[model samples]
Target: MGSGPTAVEIISHLNSSWQKVRGYQTETEVAEYRNGKLQITKSFLYSFRKPRDFRIDMHHPHRGTSLICCDAEGKILVRPGGIGAVFKKRLSPDNRLLADPSGQRIDQTDLGLLIRNIGHSLTDQRRGDMKVTDEGGRLVVESVASDHFLPGVLTRYRFVIEKGTWLPAQVVELTPEGVLKRVVTFGTVNLLSDFPPGFFISDREDRGGGGR
Candidate 1:
């Protein structure tokens, strides 16, 4: 209830924490809704390194499927699940096959992009109507905007940040009428200075069951 960190201050904290991260691995769960109904939920073991290296191991729905991109400009390598795991395919970054249920591309799902988007939304606002509160033991930052803060979506963003790490534990997006649009929850984050050799290499020879 007392005065908490402002939106700018929270953004600064997120930026500072992100700057120290050379790479990271985390479990991410995304729930998307439509017309006030929960449509789908997807889970993944998400891994990322600086300068656009990423690997996504789908844990729910598409179980054994894995997607990896070692270079920013190169195509995404996809290893499908089930019997399709025996084969591998490469597709462009904008390929529909590489998009999530919500149409978000794999290249756009990193924490760095999330933080940058939040900063952009806040900066575009003429009036700062952000509020920071103590929810349970976590810090909740909520902000509303007259126009759509994120692309064509006009929703209120609620960011629940973890205590010690200063990283987001969960992010909730709600429509102007208070309908839940999406919820992204981040599991325990493991920050690393570097990943082992060939960690992001998807074409490496392997038994290819699920993820590494």
Candidate 2:
């Protein structure tokens, strides 16, 4: 399918949809180039709420650690998995410990920011043309960026947006030379008006410790 929508048009629709979301939870899978081969590097259960409440529960690699950021404190409360769960640390948003291998901060991983970045790339004339096409029954927005729109890489981008919700279901980043760089998939998205009480409050915070 071709001649779907202009980049500007798609971004507008996505922003409208995103503004209606009060909260959401999703299972996320991140894959990236490692040792010159694309490998699934991390999997996590992510939860987010409006006004800056979010959580990340690592399921692979770390396997036990969880991070929670609540608007109350504006700091990341880390509860390590395994035996380390007994201890917790409250770190600044830019703390290296809160960063991924690609140096993406936890606070920057929200869907709103992702769409905004894509809008920036598409609106910049130097990034070349932006195209929206129907791929596998989804609207995929494709564009190329001359500069590193993402934190660490410059690449071509394909954002597969769920037609029903206008939210990104998957994002594929490729090297300018057309090699796969990274792909992040969002699955089982559940939208809610609000989480139950104490959802964003970690055990440490609940106990009044608030980490160190």
Candidate 3:
């Protein structure tokens, strides 16, 4: 607390940790709600490779196969056939709408990217408000005043990163005044030697052009 790693150091450590994980696949469970109502819970199986290429498959409540893929060209392919049809959209890295079902933009499965975003935001300003510490062998980081939060909501985030793996175990979203909001948990993660070709593409090659 009083004497610990600086924000920069914490960021550097997190970045290094992610570098060790060349590729991985895991199941992530997300529980989210808005304005004290409209709560929903869903699970996604995510697989990722370096430098912004990944695939997410939606499970349950929604029938059929729904998939989202992000390519190196910054294009997002959404196959909403379960809910609707397939579409492609060009969006920035931080686009909130990119998060399906849960509606929260933060990449719930990729803790490293989330930490990188937070680190980028906390640079050169009042960094003293943020703190990094260790709890029960896991590294914990918290920012009292952070802009890296859910839109329209003033909340602070606490990320619990596994010390050895450098991957996130859980993310806790809380109100500025410290009331709980959402909790996202990452399930058992398994490293992959390589991502197979077409792993990040829509199953139906014929599916084309923006929204159903």
Candidate 4:
């Protein structure tokens, strides 16, 4: 398949396919690339590292709560926070651990991202004409990449899929000001068939981390 893929075609190709990924009990290794360039490699345990935290919100005349996690070590990442978890980590795929101890759940729902969903990674594409640029408008940047993704505003973002992989190396969320609001870079991942039983959880040996 040549002739450059379209957005809809990309989604169709992705939805019709499923890749082999690892589970909680297994270790995973992932690799990151940028514009067909090698970036970084990381490994960790998914079950434990994937979950950051959980929350329950009982307010208004509605029942609501959410759980959050991040198994998207190497997959789609759309809209700052509007997508599902991606391909699970695959054990023995790469020579690295899959569980991550340093990761935080951040939210209540474990709704993480997938490899294909990374394409929807924009701020507000649904804002109709609200996401328009005024006369003589340009872009700004915090780093060399240029662009600051802002919060609660109409903006545009572009994600480039790496060739031969489902990973999106460079993600730039543009702000209403035309600057980058958020930029996420994917590093290499490690895949393992098995990991230590306790590697996924924090040891309760001392609940207090030398603090109250």
Candidate 5:
């Protein structure tokens, strides 16, 4: 459950993983192009083994999108259904975002910060004096209270990195009450040769004949 790996060590592992991923693959629905990019959109689903499911309308600009979800898996079900919504997005800046649309807020940063979090968690996990659980998992950084997700609660994190690519394939978030707050798993990475020309419309007016 515990390892000698320091925060630095975990960070290194995560960073190394990111480097392996040249980019993400996106799925599409009648894919189109505008402004020299591909616009792929679809309804997506993410599920965890413990019965957690997340839904999203994915709009992938380039790196593709994942319908991400998670929960305790393979029976021995501790929790299910997961918590909240997850929307994956990436930009030319190389930033990937998992956003909460209703929350009206998002972390502009993306994949790299996630790796740093893994490092931070690994460091904390190695602390000799922390509470130990026979069921192993990483700690969620900075918890708070309230209906948004409950107050003063701890959420444990678990994950799986893709082989060869090193991108995150799965992730989990569990509350102190053993309730699953979030779960996300990715699938079907599609490498496209070219995106549609109308893919990146600047404004409503630019939607052309497609405007509703």
Candidate 6:
């Protein structure tokens, strides 16, 4: 029998799919952790559009909702009770709001970027830090980052890409000490050819708790 697709091959397919996608929306369950124990889990509705535009609606049952939107113009963060604020900045991978706990500026939850990183890990194998394995019926690609690159924290990111969709089912972030930092599980994904007008715009300007 022949070996199935390599990590690099799967990522190539994923990257090709991303190039043609105009936009996508998905429901995600985000879990934050510390010291290897489970912390809390939150649900979010995430949407992304081409040419740098994204929105996140974090659900808080009693407290309401938190909305974060980024586009070519700037970022808008809205608090639960209708208070929101806007900042002027173009949407890019370097945006501070998109920075992860390790100070790496990336859309940590993006499937496209996650797939691309798998390719990067394979390309630059100097550290021997990447591995591909089969786990829980998904293809798992794990990449480890050294402290030299990230300054302080030595981190590992794991991507579990589903076979059928070629999209990530879950993403895990672990610290140097093997502490589980965060895990995000993706739910239903909807690829959209057209979105509503001003869907990325926010009108709330509340300054409570630095919404974003």
Number of the top-ranking candidate, with TM-score as the measure: 2
The runs of at least 3 residues in candidate 6 whose Cα sits more than 4 Å from the true structure, single-residue gaps closed, are 1-4, 61-63, 70-72, 82-109, 135-137, 146-152, 203-212
Question: What residue runs in model 1 are displaced by over 4 Å at the alpha carbon?
Answer: 101-103, 126-128, 146-150, 204-212
Candidate 3 minimal-lDDT segment of 10 residues: 100-109
lDDT of 1 by residue, 7-120 (tens): 678789889998988889999999999977899999999999987898989999789898888744566778889998777777777776655555567688788887776775
Per-model TM values vs. the true structure: 0.86, 0.88, 0.73, 0.39, 0.42, 0.72
Report the Cα lDDT for residue 44, model 4.
32
Better of 2 and 6 by lDDT: 2
How would you encode candidate 4's per-residue C-alpha lDDT over 43-108 as one tens digit per residue? 432232333321222222122211112222321111111232122222221222322221212231
Q: Candidate 3 or 5, higher TM-score?
A: 3
RMSD of 2: 2.7
Between candidates 2 and 6, the one scoring higher on TM-score is: 2
Model 5 TM-score?
A: 0.42
Which residue pairs of candidate 6 clash? Answer: 83-206, 84-204, 84-205, 84-206
List model 5 lDDT by residue over 4-81, tens digit each. 333454456568865554333422122222332433332342221111222222443322333322212211111112
Runs off by more than 4 Å, candidate 4:
1-3, 12-19, 23-152, 206-212
Prediction 1 global C-alpha lDDT: 0.76
User: Alpha-carbon error at 62 in model 3, in Å?
Assistant: 1.8
Local distance difference test, each candidate: 0.76, 0.78, 0.63, 0.31, 0.35, 0.62
lDDT of 2 by residue, 1-212 (tens): 24878776888998999999999999999998864487767899999998688999999978988888984658888878989876777887887666566556788888888877777767773366677788765798777774333454567888889988889899887876778777889996799897888788765444443433
